[model samples]
Target: MHYDVFNGDADGIIALLQLRLAEPKSAQLVTGVKRDIQLLDSLNLNSQDSLTVLDISMSSNQQGLANALQAGADVFYVDHHKAGDIPSHANLNAHIDLDAETCTALIVDALLQRRFHLWAITAAYGDNLLSKADTLALQAGLSQQQAAQLQELGTLINYNGYGEDVEDLHFHPAELFQKLLAYDDPFAVIADKHSPYYILKEAYAVDMTLAQSLVASYQDSQLSVFILPDTSSSRRVSGVYGNWLANQAPNHAHLVLTLNSQQDYTVSLRAPLTNKQGAGELCSQFASGGGREAAGGINHLPKASLELLIQSVSDYYQVTASST
Candidate 1:
C-alpha cells in the first residue's frame, strides 16, 4: 500500500494536491489538524509500501522515518522546516528547504514546473507569506482582483485546518482535500457556490470576529501576547489570528495562546515579520514545541511556564530587534 501523509493545513494539502494532480495516485491518505505533526508513527510499513510525506518536520518524525526506511518503505519527503540531520538511505528521497520565504507547496510547484502556479500562490498566501505570495502573483501576471481572490481562498482553506482536532474543523483535512480535488484551479472553488470555500469563508468570518475582540494579555515594546479561552473557536482561530497579529505589527513578535482541554496553553508564536528568525528555536526550548523560523507552535504550555515564555520571547526579540 502507498500512503500520502501530509499536514492538514493549506501548505500541506496544496503540496499533495499539486503532486496528485500532476501524477494521479491512488494512495491511502493520512493527515490531521494543523498541529498534529507526528503522523508518520501511526503507520506500520513494509517493503511493499511507499510513502509521500509533505509539510511536516523531519526532526519530529525522525524515528518514524527511520522505522519506515528499516522496514524498506520507499519514501519521498518534502518540507520547509528545521530538519536536524537527514538520514542517508537508498529508499529515502528528501527535498528540504529551511528558507523562511519558501514553503512545501512552492517547492512542489517548482518540481512540477509551475503546472499549478496559481495553487502554489494560494498556498503561500495561506501560509501567511503575504509579501512572497504577492510578488509571485505579480510575477505570474495576475491582476490585482485575481490575486485578492486567491489570497481570500487561501486564507479560508488555511483557516479550516486549525483546531484542536478534526471535530473542531469545518471539514476534516482529508474530506476537504477530496472536495478540492474536483477543481484544478482555486478560482473554480471560489466560483462554485457549493464548494467548501463558501462554508469555510462564513466560518472564518465568525471566528475572526471573536478573535478580533480579544485584547493582548501581555503587551510590551517588542512583544505582544494574547490569551484565548478554551473554546473550539479559539483553538480553530489561534494560528491564523497570530498571523493576523503579526501582520498588524510587522515589527513586533506576537504570541497567541489558547487554553486547551488539558488546561494548558496551545501556543502559536510568530517572529516579527521584519526579523523572521528564532521563533522555532524559542518554541523548541519548551516541550511539545517546534516549527519553522518564521512561525512555530507549542502543543502544550503549562500555566506556570507562561511568564517564562513571555519573557523569553520578549528578550529574544528585544535583542534581535536591537541588533538589527
Candidate 2:
C-alpha cells in the first residue's frame, strides 16, 4: 500500500499533484486544514508499504515517523517547516528545507522540472510568494492576465483554509482538492465561465467583508494592535485582517489576536512592511510560535497572559523602533 499525506491547502495539494503527474501512482490522500499538521500518524503503514508526505511539519510527527521507519516502512518526507533532530534510518528519505521564502510546491516543482509547473506557480502564489510566482509564470509562458488569475485562485484557496474548523471554511480542503483535480490545469478551471471559480470568488468576498468589519484598532505612537472578536469568522479571517492593518498603518507594526474555542487566543504578528522581519522570534519568546522573520503565529495563548503578551509585543515594537 502507498499513502500520500499532505497539507490540505493549495501548496500541499499542488505538490502532491506534481508528484502524481510525474510518478503516476495510486495512493490514498490524508489531509486536513492548514493547521492540521502531522497527518501521517493516523495511517496504518506496513513494513513493505511506502509513504509520501508533503508540506507537513516533521517535528509534529517525529515519534510516529520514527516508529514507522523502524517498522521498515519506506518514507519519503518533503516539507518546509521547523524540523528538530531528524532520525537516521535506511527506510527514511527526508527532504526537509526550512527556507522562509520557499514552499513545498516550489521545492517539488524544482525537483520535478517544468512538469505541472503551472500548478506549482499557483501553489507558490497561494503561499504568498507572489513576486516569485509571477516570475515563474512568465518563464512558463503565461500571459500576465493568466498569471494574475492563477494567483487569485491560489490566494482564494489558501484563504479557504484559514477558518477555525471545516464549518467556517468556504469548502473542506479535501473537497477543494476534488474540485481542483477535476481540471487538468488550474488556469483552465479558473477561466471557465461556469466553474467553481465563481463560487470561490463569492465566498472570498463574503469572508473579506466580515474580516474587514471586525477589526478593533488601537495605536500608541509606534505600536498598533487589532483585537478581533472571538468568533469562528474572526479566526478564519485573522491573517487577512493582519495584512490589511499592516498596510493601512504602514508606520506601525500590527498584532492580530483572536479568541479561539478553548477561550484561548490565537495571535498573528506582522512587522511593518518597512521592517518585514523578526515577528516570529518575538512571538516565540513569550509563547509557542515560530516562523520566518516577517510573519508568525501562536496557536493557543491563555487568556490570563493576554495582557502580558500584548505588553511584551508592544515593548518589543517600541524598543526596535527606537533603536532604528
Candidate 3:
C-alpha cells in the first residue's frame, strides 16, 4: 500500500498535488482539518507500505514516524516547519527547509524543476508569503490580474481547510484534492465557473465580512488579541484573519483564539511581520502547539491560560522590537 499523508491546507494539498500530477500514483489518502497535524499516529502500516508525508512537522509526529520506520515502512517527508533533530533512519527520505519565505509547495516545486510553478506560486500566496509570491508571480510573467486570480484561488482552498472537522468544510480536503486532480493547470480550475474556486470565493466573502466586523478583545501597540466564536465560519476564517491583522499592523503581534468545545481556544499566533522571530517559540510553550517562526498555532489552549499566552507574546515582541 501507498499512503499519501498531508496537511489539508493549501500548501500541503498543493504540494502533494504537484508531485502526484508530475508522477501519477495510487495511494491511500490520509488527511484532516488544518489543525490535525499528527496524522502519522492514525496510520496502520507495514513493511511493504510506502508513505509520503507533506507540510506537517516531523517533530510533532516523530514517534509515529519512528514506529513506522521500525515496522519497515519507507517514508518520504517534506516540510517547512520546525523539525527538531531529524532521525537517521535509512527508511526515511526527508527534505525540510525552514526558510520563512518558503512553503512545502515551493520545496516540491524545486524538486520538480517548476513543472507546476504556478500552483507553487499560489501556495506561497495562500501561506501569506505575500512579497515572495508577488515576486515569483512577476518572474513567471503572469499579469497582475492573473496573479490575483491565483492568489484568490489559493486563499479559498486554504480557507476550506480551516474548520474543526471535514463536516464543517465546504468540501472534505480529500474530496477537494480529488476534484483538483482533473485540472493540472491552476488556470483551468479558475476557467470552470462551476469549480470549487467559485463556491469558495462566495463563501469567503461572507466569512471575511463577518470577521472584519469583529473588534479585538485586547489591543495595544505591542500586541492584539481576538476571541472568536466556535462557529464554522470562525474556524474557516481564523488563520486568514490572523494574516490580515498582521498585514494591517506589521509591527504588532496578533493572537486569534477560536473557542473549541473543550472550553479552550484553538490559538493562531503570528509574530510581527517586521519581527518574525518568536512565534514558533512562543507557541511551542503550549503542549499542542508548534510551527515556524512567522506563524504558529496551538490545537487547544485553556481559557484560564489566555493571560499567560498574551504576556509571553507581548514580551517577546517588546524586546525584539526595541533591539531592532
Candidate 4:
C-alpha cells in the first residue's frame, strides 16, 4: 500500500494532483492545514509500504521521520523548506532544494515535465510566485487571461489554508481538492456553475476588510505591527492580513501577531520588498521559524515576550535606518 502525505495548501494539493495524473494509482492521502506539518507520525507504514511526502519539511519532523524511515518504509520526500541535516537511509529518497523562488510544485514539474506541467503553474501561482507562474503559463500555451484566472484560483486556494484551524479556513483544502478534480482544467473549474470561487472571493473580501480595520501602530519609522484577537478567523487570516499590511505600508516591515485559543501567539513577519533578506533569520532567533529571505514566521511566541519582541522589532528597524 502507498500513502501520500502533503501540506493541505495549494502546493501540496497541486503536487499530489500532478503525481496522481502521472501515476494514476489509488493511494490514501494524509493532509491537514498549513500548521499540520507533523502528519507523518500518525501513519502506519511497514517495510513494504511506500510513502511520498510533499511540501512538508523534514526539519520540522526530523525525529518522527527518522523513526519512520528506520522502520523500513520507502519514503520519497520533496520539499523546499530549510533542512538542517538530513539523515542518510537506503529507503529514503529526498529531493529537497531550498530556493526561495522555487516551490515544491516547480520541483515536481522539473522531475515530471510533460506529465504535469499545467498543474505546476497552478501551484506556483498559489505560492505567490506570480512572475514564475506567468512565465510557465505562457510556455504551456495559456493566454494572458487564462493565466490570470488560474493565478486567481491558485491564490484563492492558498489563501484558504492560512487560518489557525480548519474552522477558520474558507474550505478544507482536502475538500477543495475534490472539487478541483471535477474539472480537467482549473480554469474550467473556476468558471463552473457550482464553482466555490465565488464564495472564496466573498470570504476574502470580508476578511481583508476586517484586517485593514485592525491596525497596531509602532514608534519606528520603518516598522508596523498589528495584533489580532484570539479567534479562529483572526488566526486563519493573519498571514494574509500581514501581507496586506505590508502592501499598505511599503516603506515599513509589517508584523501580524494573533493570539490563539491557548494564549500563545503566532507571528507572521514580512520585511519590506527592499530588504527582505534577513527576516527569516530574525524570526528564527526567537522561535521555531525559518523561511526564504523575504517572508517567514514564528510558530509560537509567548504573550509575555510580546511587548519586548515588538520593541525589538522597532529597535531593529531603527538600527537599519541609521546604518543605511
Candidate 5:
C-alpha cells in the first residue's frame, strides 16, 4: 500500500495537494489535527509499502521512520521543522529546510518548478510567512486585492486546522484536501462562493471575534499570554489567534493557552516576528512540545508550569532582542 501521511495544517495539506495535482497518485491518506504530528506511529509498514510524509517534525517520529526504512519502504519526506540527525538509508529521500522565512510548500514549489505557484504562495501566507508570501505574490503579478483574497483563504484554511479534534473542525483535513483538489488554481476556490472558503471564512470570523474579546491573562513588554477557556471555539482558534496576536505586535512574543479536559493546557507559542529564533527551542524544553523556529506548541502543559513557560519565553526573547 502507498500511504500519503501529512500534517493537517495548511502547509502540509497544500504541499501534498501540489504534488498530487501535478502527478496524480493513488494512495491511502493519513492525517490528523494540527497537533497530531506523530502520524507514522499509527501505520504498520512492510517491504511493499511506500510512504510520503510532509510538514511534520522528523525527530518526533524518528522511531517510526526508522522502522519504516528498516521494513524497506521507500519514503519521501519533506518538512521545514527540526530534523535531528537524518538517517542515512537509500530508501529515505528527505528534503528539509529550517529557514525561518520558508515553509514546506515553498520547498515543494521549487521542486515542481512552480507548476502550482499560486497554491504555494497561499500556503506560505497560511504558514505565517507574511512578508515572504507578499513578495512572492508581487513577483507573480498578483494585484493587492488578489493577494488579499489568497491570504484570507489561506488563513481560513489554517484556522480550520487548529481544532483539538476532527469533530471540532468545520471540515476534517482529509475532506478539506479532497474538496480543494478540484481546483488547480487557488483563485478558483475563492471565486466559487459555495466552496469551503466561504464556510471557513464565516466560522473564522466568529471564532476570531471571541478570541479578540478576551484580554490577555498576562502581558508585559517582552511577552503576552492569553488563556482561552475550554471550548470548541477556543480549540479552533488558538493557533490562528496566536498568529494574529504576533502580527499585531511583531516585537512581542505571544502565547495562547487553551484549557483541555485534563485540566492542563494546550499551548501555542509564537516567537516575536522580529526575532523568530527561540520558540522551538523554548517549547522543546517541555515534554509534549516541539515545532519550528517561528512557532511551537505543547500538546499538554500542566497548570503549575504555566509561569515557567512564560518566564522562559520572556527571558529568551528579551535577551535575543538585546543581543541583536
Candidate 6:
C-alpha cells in the first residue's frame, strides 16, 4: 500500500501536486485543515507500505514516525518546519530545510529540477513567500501581468485553508487538490471559471470585506492587535488577514485574535517582515502556541491572559525592533 500524507495548505498541496504530476501514482491521501499537522497518527502502516509525508513537522509526528519505522514502513518526508532529531534508518528518507525562506513546495521543486517550477512559484506565493515568489516568477520568464494573476490565484487558494475545519472551509483540501490536479497549470484553473480558483476568489472577497471593517483592539508603533468576534467569517479570515496586516505594515508585528467556542481566544501572530524572528518564540510562551519564526499562533488563550499576551508581544517587538 502507498500513502500520501501532507498538510492541507498551499505548500503541501502544491508539493504533492508536483510529485504526482511528475510520477503518476496511486496512494491513499491523508490531509486535514491547515492546522491539522499530526497526520501520521491516524495511519496504520505496515512493513510494505510506502508513505510520503510533506509540509508537516516531524517533531509533532515523532511517535507516529517511530512506530511506522518499527513496522518497517518506508517513509519519504519533506518539510521546512522545526524538525527535531530525524531517524537515520535506511527505511526513512528525510529532506528538511530550516531555511526561513524555504517551503516544502520549493524543496520539492529543487528535487524535481523545476519540472513544475511555475506551480512551485504559485505555492510560494500561496505560502506568503511573496519576495521569493516574485523572484521565481521573473526567473521563469513570466510577464508582470502573468505574475500578478499567479499571485492572486495563490492567495485565494491559501485563503480557503484558513478555516477552523473542513466544515468551515469552502472545499475540503483533498477535494480542492483533486479539482486542481485536473489542470497541470494554475492558469488553466483560473481560466476554467468553474474551477475551485474562481469559487475561492469570490468567497475570499466577501470575507475580506467583513474583516477590513474590524478595528484593531490594540495598536502601537511596534505592534497592532485585532480581536475578532467568533463568527464563521472570523475563523475563515484570520490567517490570511494576518498575512495582509503583516504586508501592510512590514515594520510592525500583527496579531489577530478570535474568540473560540471555549470563550478563550485563538491567536495568530506575525512578526515584522523586516525582522521575521521572535514570533514563534513569543507565541510559544503560552500553551498550545508555536510556529515558524515569521508566523505562529496560540490555539487557546484564556480571556484573563489577554492582557499578559498583549504585553509580552509588545515587549518582544520592542526589543527585536530595536536590534534590527
lDDT per model vs. reference: 0.95, 0.76, 0.92, 0.77, 0.94, 0.88
Q: What TM value does model 1 have?
A: 0.99
Task: Compute the lDDT of residue 214 as modeled in candidate 2.
Answer: 54
Give me the overall lDDT of model 2: 0.76
Residue 38, model 2: lDDT of 59
Clashes of 6: 0
Residue pairs in clash, model 1:
none
Error of 4 at 232 (Å): 3.0
For model 3, give the 10-residue run with minimal summed lDDT.
272-281
4 or 5, which is superior by TM-score? Answer: 5
TM of each candidate vs. truth: 0.99, 0.86, 0.98, 0.88, 0.99, 0.97
Write the residue-wise lDDT of candidate 2 on 172-253 in tens digits. 7777776777676887887787776788788677767876765356667766777777777676667766766776876677
Please give, for residues 1-324, the per-residue lDDT of candidate 1 as tens digits: 999999999999999999998989999999999999999999999999999999999999999999999999999999998888999999999999999999999999999999999999999999999999999999999999999999998888888889998999999999999999999999999889999999988888999999999888889999999999999999898888999999999999999999999998999999999999999999999999999999999999999999999999999999988999
Badly placed stretches (over 4 Å) of model 3 are none
lDDT of 1 at 292: 93
lDDT digits (tens) for residues 20-80 of candidate 3: 9999999999999998999999988899999999999998998999989999999999999
Backbone steric clashes in candidate 3, count: 0
- Which run of 10 residues does model 4 get worst, by summed lDDT? 273-282
Better of 1 and 2 by lDDT: 1
- Against the true structure, candidate 2 reaches a TM-score of 0.86
324 Cα displacement, candidate 5 (Å): 0.5
Task: Please name the candidate that would achieve the greatest lDDT relative to the true structure.
Answer: 1
